[model samples]
Target: MAGLPVALAAAGALAYGTAFGLFGEDARTTAGAAAPAWAEEAADGFASVDALGQKGTYGGRGGPVVTVRTLADLEKYATAPGPHVIVVAGAIPVNPVGKEIKVASDKTIIGSGTSGHIVGGGFFLGPGVHNVIIRNLTIRDTYQGVWNDKDHDFDAVQMDGAHHVWIDHNDLRHMADGLIDSRKDTSYVTVSWNRLGNNNKTFGIGWTENTTADLTIHHNWFRETEQRNPSTDNAAHAHLYNNYLQDDPGTAVTSAYGNYARGRTAMVLENSYFQGLTNPVIKDATASLVQRGNVFSGTRGRNESGGTGFDPRRFYPYTLDAAADVPAIVTAGAGPRSALGTPRAAATRTLTVAKDGSGQFTSVQKAVDAVPAGNSSRVVIQVKPGTYREAVKVPSNKPHVTLQGMGASRKDTVLVEGRASGTPRPDGSGTYGTGGSATLAVEADDFQARNLTVANDFDEARNQHLTGHQAVALRTAADRVLLDALIISGDQDTLLLDTAAKDRPGRVRLTNSYVIGNVDFVFGRATAVIDRSVLTLKKRWDGTSAGYVTAPSTPAGRKGFLITRSTVNGDVTAGSFFLGRPWHAGGDATLDPQTTVRDSVLSAAVRPAPWTDMGGFSWKDDRFAEYRNTGPGAGPAGADRPHLTDAQAADQEIADWLGDWTPAAG
Candidate 1:
């Protein structure tokens, strides 16, 4: 434990050493109690186990039981002798001295509760290791071994040349490399009920020449994870079903073929839900993939590759879950904590806020500050129908918070602030960035707000003297956020779906909402979906030409903005407002922005040439496409407006975009 943090090191020496006995009876006796409810359900729902594939009991059955409370104890039990049911208790933070903590054959290491945590270090199931189960643990901040070094790649859970593994009910985040990776002949693995987020490479199944990997990943929630949401490479047979993927900046499931030896990577992705994703499925010409019963709402790019003619059932024996039922099922059961377990009474802890002191607090910020730190459960802060001029923020640690407005109409309840990008700090420091210049800013995950108005009442003409006049009404850097029936109003940069960074993109789902702005009003790098929403363009007070509706700064190879099944109408003059213009941040030539408007109604305010060049970048070089658009703006004659063909349009459905995330009616 050389790299152990002082806090973890202070937890003292290892407890419960080598007193445990071997075999099923001894293990059961040592375990003391039965498995948790989640564990039982995981076992019953494991696809590999239910399919009757592979070797002996996959999770510490017929083995010895040992409880570990420290990093040293975990290391001892994980590597000592054979077949162990290692119960890890308390927060075990590991700053590993070696490559990683290694796990031997036939082992089940489960956390006692949500308390079990592995920080800075990770577990490695290396060559010849088989029949393992790693469950109910929170693995975070994994060691960043060597940068861009494949051999020394650090992952929270790495299965190499291993088989018969079940990784379930675990929460993994902020890992350096892959969160969960399986490669080199690994077979018969099921990854379920895990919540993976804020990772660069989320999941990787097969490697260059490892063709024998068979992975089943289902009912897991992947939030704001980047590339390799299980990138099946070179002969990997992966079945991805009933998973909830939200705001993935990169492709969720990519069937990649190696250059040296291109094997048939067969992936059956069905009944999955995708929201605010760049590309749901990336099938190369050499790969074999099939997608069915998936739902997509505000997603960009084509869902499937042009390649076809591969049947998934021919390779694996498994029953397909209905895609229509997947959203409800996965949302209810996926992740470490069951969504169903979220008490209805949690909403009862409502803190009411009103401008006239008719509620518990006078302002929204007061109610938010009163919330207990590390609040695990959902807490609703109700705002009565009144305009409160304040800047509000929901910090990162205060998750599962909802800001509800008790307003009959969205315009009735308003949270208004007047901070532009050039607005200096109260302490007389430099101005806030575009992300910081928001009336309402949310950084917490699982945040929700409905039936309210977040308005940046900064007058664009008054702020014309400032250089960066971008004022955002709402800025969200959160995951799994839902904004419904809301009105976000501003001038430039009205609604900023801002993220912490380019690598860590935010996720927000907007439905039946109204966004009104001028120049690049709705912009950011976040993967945002605007479904059945209204995007309106307002005329500048100074009679300046109504600027671009969007100036998306989405990272290269990522989805920026999607307005689907919605309406874009405004009071602007005809041929004045272009749909969007690409914003090249820091003169990055590689930044290719993506924006799509399909199956929507556009007014005459939208120019015939809807996309234009901005910041020395051509909109034509970016990904801006429309399909089946019906309005005066819809045309086949415009050179700037790119239209999708019938075949391409067939792949651009909302069902294909959202995967299986069917948002409830607003």
Candidate 2:
């Protein structure tokens, strides 16, 4: 009874303390930390209106009007003391990075109109600056649309991070890197309501490293961009809601590192649309993200030798909308992902090839060589079902070339094969290395090879010296390359799904086809979907056969490889084929890249220890994933091989690696 009085007194003191703390309100937490020296004393000088219509530039303080005439005058007033607000009217600025407008702390730059542009370059932010708002402007022709390279970064405009920022209502285009990046810092930022485009290079958002957290990217339009780079894999725990992403014909949109073994990142993508071009979408991870309702239009290209790996959950949202120009589905919220509401002309304009000697030659490759590049009109060479012995090379200049073979993917096969290393060309003064000792070499972007079989028939022993003896089948190094019902065959580097170089990782789709090879043959860096294809390995007499089938040489910062809904078979002895080996030039297996296989069939010929170690290195560093594969080759859980859980398989973080784009099982 005596202790009750003490308890009541203590409770009363605690309540009084809590009330005082709540009423006092820490200024730093409520109004943000101290402003940088470069920032003016107050934020009330410029013209600004609050949500409730209260007007002030320096937070309603009666400050001087920070008058600026030209882009340079704005820069001068930005650094001064008396004027708080910085009214940037007239034309876009010139050299914003070098001048006075260096984005001081605690400031806002509200553009005059959607046409209020940033002409010279993007506004670069230094490290540690906080509390900034940049909105309602047209940003173009900068190194990056909005460049923020510092480590401790946050962003508002949907670009990369700079921390403590608000970026909304802008049209940003023609940049070298990502439109927005937030790979660094635990920045709570909101990037909403913007239009993002690529002037020439890769990515709409470049989320890198492991630091970014609590980011919301919503209601953004990513239209008419080119070549989404593989380095944009750093977006962890990101919310991508109601966005529209589309590219023109021949461009590639790929989401790299979704299945990264370092650990699956969390990405939430809902109510979005992706459409058009060669590779509408590509993913390379087994990430942990949520992609509830996304529509990916257009058929993903077939990999060299045929088939694609577009996952069912991620890629299934893409319905066959015959009315849509790009064969993709339209989602809620955003405008359609593409300018044209439907698929390419190939959807409607079917190619039928018959010759009463009307064309130059009966073969498809010959017709491609006859046509010139930059031809606005398309040339559809309808191919009849016969074994044509020749190599095909479609260069970058030769655009809009479509080769339609006679038959459905499974039934029809127009075969093309070559034998010698230096085969004589039609002009025939010398020989060209079209197939590099094998068959067809397709190097054309925006090129479609439908219902065809491209093969290589080089007898290994015939080429006495193994020095210049690398064989090839169909080497596709083009962006937006589609291989529908295509069959490719050879030994050793057979279907070289290779890029032109390391810099250019193309997007390819291999659907409803077959590829048969031995050794480290099926390999390269192309973001390919080997969906519903049969990969067979013929018997090899040579004891020198490595027996490794697919060697993915995906670079450190690139989307590695994906083999989904396909079959792997071999005629050789069981446990003869090593599923894959790391493709490092120095034979170092430690720098392992990411590779995944899901819902496919395998043969007993595949080794139980699926991954092969090279040059005294462990395979643990390598990134590899397999889900629900059935066959004798897919053995029980062991050291070298691990099974993917149903939850891991369903994670949208990894689904983004497949663009979470799935096509219907026809």
- Scored by TM-score, the top model is 1
Candidate with top lDDT is 1
The C-alpha lDDT values of all candidates are: 0.69, 0.51
In model 1, state the lDDT of residue 599.
Answer: 86
- Which regions of candidate 2 are displaced past 4 Å? 1-360, 376-378, 408-413, 420-435, 464-468, 542-546, 586-592, 615-618, 645-666
Tens-digit lDDT track of model 1 for 86-131? 7654455576522468999777787543435566668999887877
lDDT of 2 by residue, 1-666 (tens): 110111122221111000000001111111233332222322211112122222222321223333233566555544444324343332444653322235654455544322245544455434544455555555555443233333322222233344555555666665444455444442444555567665333333443556344445556666665544212254444455555666556544332211111123455555655654444334445444545455666636521111121232231122222322222322232221111111112222233443444435765566777667776545676776555666667777876677766644422444546454455546776654534554667677656666665667766665555344456777878765666666666676778777777678666667666777787667777766676777877665364434877777666666666778888875578788877767765564434555677788998888888887644554456767678899888876666787677445533121233221211111
Which regions in candidate 1 have their CA more than 4 angstroms from the true location? Answer: 1-348, 637-639, 650-666
For model 2 the TM-score comes to 0.46
Count of residue pairs whose backbone atoms collide, per candidate: 11, 69
Cα RMSDs, all models: 16.7, 23.5
